[model samples]
Target: MAEAAAITWALELAVIEMFEHICIESDAKVYVNALAATIDDCLWKIRALISMSLKLSS
Candidate 1:
């Protein structure tokens, strides 16, 4: 679970540092869907990745 979160952070860094376009593939539907949706999920690890992702995009 933490490894998944770590991957999310790594992806965030990759987006922020290098890639202009990125595609992510994963077997974990929950995490994938969570990233796609705008709903508020309060789990800290997930939220951290979400925050980093938004930061990267903005």
Candidate 2:
């Protein structure tokens, strides 16, 4: 679950950095839903940061 979130967050940041929209296709409905829900702040922050870094790299 954590890894999936990280990947999703990274993809989102990348899409943002590219100034393009993103449409994520995933089979993990629970994961997707949880992203919008309040849970695991530390994991979310870490994943968000990683995603931002990935976006900046490109």
Candidate 3:
């Protein structure tokens, strides 16, 4: 879950960086921590997907 949250945060940052001006908001601290936990098991796949999304968005 931590991995997922980190991926989400990364993706959000990527989008913000790509767009230049935009407000990103999230109220789920638990979800954010979930992504930051570790890139193990299925979390790695989630991270890959987020990375791909950022690349495609860019």
Candidate 4:
């Protein structure tokens, strides 16, 4: 959960600044996979942030 929140905040910063590129590194597979999961399937509290992160990926 801490990992998710941190990633979310970083993503939000990137979004706000209109950064063209962003990279994320993690040692936790579960949280990483969860963020990469499809929006429709994810049930985590950070779903909104996950969706935003996914959008940034594309």
Highest TM-score scorer? 4
* Per-residue lDDT of model 3, residues 1-58, tens digit only: 4544555566677776786544435565544343345434324535665445445435
Give the better candidate number (1 or 4) by lDDT.
Answer: 4
For candidate 3, report its TM-score.
0.33
The alpha-carbon deviation from the true structure for residue 9 of candidate 2, after best TM-score superposition, in angstroms, is 7.2
The estimated TM-scores of all candidates read 0.59, 0.41, 0.33, 0.65
What order do you get sorting by TM-score, best first? 4, 1, 2, 3
> lDDT, candidate 3, residue 57?
39
Instruction: Tell me how far the alpha carbon of residue 47 in candidate 2 is from the true structure, in angstroms, after superposition.
Output: 7.6
Per-residue accuracy of model 4 over 1-58 as CA lDDT, tens digit each: 6777777788878888988888889886666877656677776676776776776656
lDDT of 2 by residue, 1-58 (tens): 5656555566766766785655556675555555555455335545554444344434
TM-score of 1: 0.59
Q: Which regions of candidate 4 are displaced past 4 Å?
A: 40-48, 55-58
The per-residue C-alpha lDDT of model 3 at residue 47 equals 60
Which should have the higher lDDT, number 1 or number 2? Answer: 1
Cα RMSD to the true fold for all candidates: 2.7, 6.1, 6.7, 2.4
lDDT of 1 by residue, 1-58 (tens): 5645765677877875887776777786666776777738635557767666556655
State in Å the error of residue 7, model 2: 3.1
lDDT of 1 at 43: 52
Itemize residue pairs with steric clashes in candidate 4.
none
Q: What's the number of clashes in each of the models?
A: 0, 0, 11, 0
Which is the leading candidate under lDDT?
Answer: 4
lDDT of each: 0.66, 0.55, 0.50, 0.74
